[model samples]
Target: MKPEIIDHLSEKQIQELCQLFQSTWWAKGRKLPDVQRMLNHSDLIVALCHHSSRQLLGFSRILTDYVYRAILFDVVIRDNYRQQGLGKILMEAIINHPDLQEIEGLILFCQPEVIPFYQKWGFWGKSDRLEIMIRPAAETELLQEKAGSLMN
Candidate 1:
């Protein structure tokens, strides 16, 4: 059956997506984002593939501005649905989406082994221009607290 791509997922759908993420090896044991948090972000894009009966077969999202840049995220297919080209279909739909077509660039961070899969969609690592950094959750909380105090 042909899969349908849905742009907006309901709260239930978001929960299902989180569950899917948690079950996967890549995201296993990872904390899921809250549904309200997902909805509050204008740049968030959730693409879901559903069967004729409306069962979710695959999912993906992009964080982006319509013109400048986009970060592809959470691209995955249910274990049973892999190897059927559904991943390609989902990625193509996201990359060629009308709202995303004008983007100057798209980015995603994947493991070394997954480089070839992303390369198929034209993503390349910038060997000379890349600097990776991480800020812990405590730092994020401190920032949020400072911002809250300034607002009051």
Candidate 2:
């Protein structure tokens, strides 16, 4: 069956999204409340769903100013649906999305090994003028606070 791209997600789809992220090495053990907050705050969320079954095959989101810049995040295709080009389908949806198409650029951070996959979609890493930087969250402190709360 052909897959359809959708911008809005139902509560069930949001739960599925939480589960999908929880399975990823980068986001393993991500909390549902955190996922819900992310969804609530994002500029856009898109998913690929089976045309017949309507099962969510892939998911991703963008945080954008709609005119100047956009960042892609939480891009994942369900494990069972990988290697069938669903990723490309999802990227195309993002590229053509009305709210994103006029932006100056789209950016995402992926592991070094996955560069080729994104390169095919016109995202370049070799920029003479641009560099990527990050400030990671304080995981240990956050975890301790969470545990401390649970014990109360």
Candidate 3:
């Protein structure tokens, strides 16, 4: 069945997304309340849903200035549903969405394995002159502890 792409999502749909995130590397510990709050604050949320059941087959969110920058987060497709071009469909919706049409940059970070997947849409890798840096959040203490132990 052809999935319908939508700009808004319900709480149940967000819960479904929380479940999907738990199965992935990037968002494994993501909480439902956090997901809800993020959805509430996000500039845009896009979902690809099964046309009949309205179940979310794919999802992504954009945090943008609507002018200078848009950062993509939590782009995912349900495990049983990958390799079907759903990601391309989701990206097309985001890239073509009027709110993002004039943004100077759209950015996302992904695992090395997925570089080629995003490059198809014109996303490039880190360059020598450009570096990405982040200040780790205090909320990541557990992850930091785990990594610290791994280094021991």
Candidate 4:
């Protein structure tokens, strides 16, 4: 089936997208925002829906300035629809979008097991020059508080 891919998501679509995200293993039980919040924050959002029925099947967002770089996030395909090539289709649509075509590079982080899947789109393990550093939200907040106190 040829899915209908939409560059702009509706309010209802945003809610459904969040629902899919919450249920996905990658999200780790995080609660996503509602439609208004999503619209306010997303630089670009896309959704794949059934052509005839208009049911949302997958969704993704890109954070970019239409140049230099773009980050793909919240890529999710509904559980029942996996293995149907929808993920790849959605990704292709985003990467090949007219406005995004000039982007210097695209990046995303996924679990080790899915590295192969992302590799199909040209993403690979980082080089030695790249080092990833992570800080949990709680730790970041604690450090910020300490700094604030020290400055007082």
Q: Model-by-model lDDT, in order?
A: 0.70, 0.83, 0.84, 0.76
**Model 4 per-residue lDDT tens digits across residues 26-122:** 5544444544575578898777998877778998888887789888887889889999999899988887888788999988867677889889888
Root-mean-square deviation of candidate 2: 6.1
Candidate 2 residues 39-142, lDDT tens each? 89999988998887777889999999999899998899999999998999998998888888789988887777789999988997756886554433565865
Residue-wise C-alpha lDDT for candidate 1, range 47-71, written one tens digit per residue? 6566555666787777887788888
lDDT ranking from best candidate downward? 3, 2, 4, 1
What alpha-carbon RMSD in Å does predicted model 3 have with respect to the real structure?
Answer: 3.2
Model 3 clashing residue pairs (backbone):
none
**Candidate 2 or 1, higher lDDT:** 2
TM-score for each predicted model, relative to the true structure: 0.78, 0.85, 0.89, 0.80
Candidate 1: regions farther than 4 A off? 30-36, 139-152
Stronger candidate by TM-score (3 vs 4): 3
- Scanning candidate 1 in windows of ten residues, the lowest lDDT window is 143-152
- Residue-level lDDT tens digits of model 3 in 36-112: 88889998888899998888899999998888999998889999989888888888898888888899999987767
TM-score of 4: 0.80
The TM-score obtained by model 3 is 0.89
User: Which residue pairs clash in candidate 1?
Assistant: none
